[model samples]
Target: MVSRILVPAARTAAAARSGLTMRSIVRGFQTSNVVRQEAATVVAPVKKPVGAFRGGLFGFLLGATASGAGMYYYVIDEYRVSNELLTEDIYALQTAVQRIEGYVRTLEEKVHSKKK
Candidate 1:
């Protein structure tokens, strides 16, 4: 029982010492940079100004791109709706054709019976 208690306490003491030593070692390496100002005057960069033609062309292109994207999505949605309607019409036609085939079979049977 004594050994079990002492073993855990000894491990905890060693862990505490190691953690303190590691923090001190990190603190010893910390440094602050010293900045020296030599030049009193700062130079400004030269920038070209945008002309009226350049600004107008940029605005026109931006508007055209936005409208083109919107029209593309609208066309896609319209195509999907039209495809759905066409599929419905095709299914209706298929059902009508099947019904006509049934009526033809019945008429053929009646004519056969009369001949017999």
Candidate 2:
């Protein structure tokens, strides 16, 4: 009850001492447009970034080069691994065929010897 009144009164006194009351704030806002207009007449508009297009192009080229190199490395590595596996498979198949040929020749020699 009394506290509410005292609080408002204290705030008003403080605002008066600080020169920051609502009316003064509103008056400042009313005067601000004139300052803004004067500043607008004195200052230049901001310019666009001169290097923006060049920077973007350089970034795109760098990304493309990196992606191309990565793809080339991946393909070369895959091919090397695939070729190694194929060579191993071919070597195993050749060894198996040689063993089968040896057995067939041995059986043929036995049959020929039995004929005599």
Best by lDDT: 2
lDDT of each: 0.77, 0.83
TM-scores, in order shown?
A: 0.59, 0.52
lDDT of 1 by residue, 8-74 (tens): 5566577677774323332234333432233324457878999999999999999999999999999
Candidate with top TM-score is 1
Model 2: runs farther than 4 Å from truth?
A: 1-52
Judged by lDDT against the true structure, how good is candidate 2? Answer: 0.83
Task: Write down the TM-score for model 2.
Answer: 0.52
